[model samples]
Target: MSTTRTHPVAGRATEVPPRSRTSPPSRRRSSRTRDRLAAAAFLTPLLAYLALFYAFPLFRNLDLSVRGYTVRNFVQGGAPFIGFDNYVKVFTSQTFVPALTHTAVFTLVSIAFQFAVGLALAVFFHSSFRLSATLRALFLVPWLLPLIVSASTWSWMLNSDSGVVNSLLRAVGVDPVNWLTDPNMALVSVLVANIWIGIPFNLVILYSGLQNIPKDLYEAAALDGATAWQTFWRVTFPLLRPVSAIVILLGLVYTLKVFDIIWIMTRGGPAGSSTTLATWTYQLGFGSLLPNFGPAAAVGNILIVLALLAGLAYIRLQRRQEA
Candidate 1:
């Protein structure tokens, strides 16, 4: 496939080979195929992890909720399908209202106090004093401690009789308060411990957010003679909105599922006075000799729905802000 052509200027014959029209398109197609294969290779592990850990467990939980599972049937694998009867039982139970109320109160109060204290500490440390870093590290002890250790420590510290808290109160000429034994105070006791454990996390996050804010804004506010409170409200809080949103959202999810701390401290005790949906779920599932697996699954599903709704609400709020 050669052709003779005349060179325009030299008036000489030259052999010009013909070009293949299909070469570039075939190379492009091959490159695209390789790129797709590489992308698939990169995504395989993550996909596999989600499928194995998340998707399968969620599906299994859903299946458990729909079936009338008992100890005998749970192992033998012949539980009868019971539609939404478990959910109905959970809804009609006397414990449901109290558990829901406790969960709401515990989650909200804990978040509020945690955020307030953490933000105050973050602002304090942002000023860069000589001992700021050391003190900040000290504050992280609560957050870094193992949950079991933290719960046990709080339990001992809030003991009805010989606790340090009661001793201090007595020294101050105040009556010794029964922190754990009193049903009215049990939730408060756990809430205080939870708040303490959560504060450092919020401080760390908010401090990072504060660091990202432009220093010039603070300088400008100072030059304009704005008070500390004014500067925080105007210059700091607005800039910190995104971090705050994420912190609150994550805290909500974590608090909703909190069982170990409450369980370890009080076993949701004092006749189920401090029981939350999380603890109630355990009580229904495994805390008794005769376990109600389906009802437990339903309670867990309700928690999942609440968390999902909160996530959707956050997304909607973010969209509105962005718009």
Candidate 2:
């Protein structure tokens, strides 16, 4: 005899179907597929963008760096495969070492001063005061101005004889200084301009970081009889570190590929005193009377490698810090 099951509905007796063991697994499988499809749908645009913009350019540059590509070859779209020859040429070039040296100096000095001044300003502006808002807004002038415009303005202002700076110095009974004309000072001048431009960016970022710190921490430090300096060193410094790391890493990357300021201000002038890797690459590719695209691409690849290493270091450091 077959058994029947009664469901509580109007006192009715109904037969129920047996449950299948395969149903749960099949449902889970369908759910997982739906999740995967959703994830892919969300990721598709970003992946497409990376492939088109970043991956494509990187591979193209790598290809160009390996081959004997030149302006003629660029027009003709054909070059002989000459592996590592271009890199050898770039390494052997007379300007490479000096350009590398200048790049290091510029990046280091600019980062130091920019961070110091920016941190000081950030700390100061973190307090509420009259005209503080206006001052902060005005401080963004250098950051907001176009690179070409800033370069031109500074170039004119640093003029040996006719500049306002020289005029002010003369008024103060000081002799005129050669800002951009002298090779010794051209790099210094460029560094100053870059530092000025970078300061506001650092200030904004650091200030935001400062604002994010809890007031309770500061109060607790005060309760522990910590003076302002001690509090900063003990509490503020440690907390600010992550932001500082991010800022410095970003500054390093931006400074590494700096091209506009040097290009506009001096054109690597006073005998290439201000030329960095970026300018050197530009010089090789287009600034030269005869463009050597292969060596230029090789130099660019070198820069890309350095940047990639920096990014990797940052990632590792961040992960360690999080841990």
Instruction: State which candidate has the highest lDDT.
Output: 1
Where model 2 places Cα greater than 4 Å from the true spot, the runs are 1-22
The TM-score obtained by model 1 is: 0.93
Clashing pairs in 2: none
Q: List model 2 lDDT by residue over 105-205, tens digit each.
A: 99999999999999999999998999999999999999999989998888888889888889999999998999887899999999998999999999999
RMSD of each: 2.7, 2.6
Cα shift from native, residue 31, model 2 (Å): 2.5
lDDT of 1 by residue, 85-180 (tens): 999999999999999999999999999999999999999999987989999999999999999999999999998798999999999999988888
Error of 2 at 75 (Å): 1.5
Candidate 1, superposed: residue stretches over 4 Å from native:
1-22
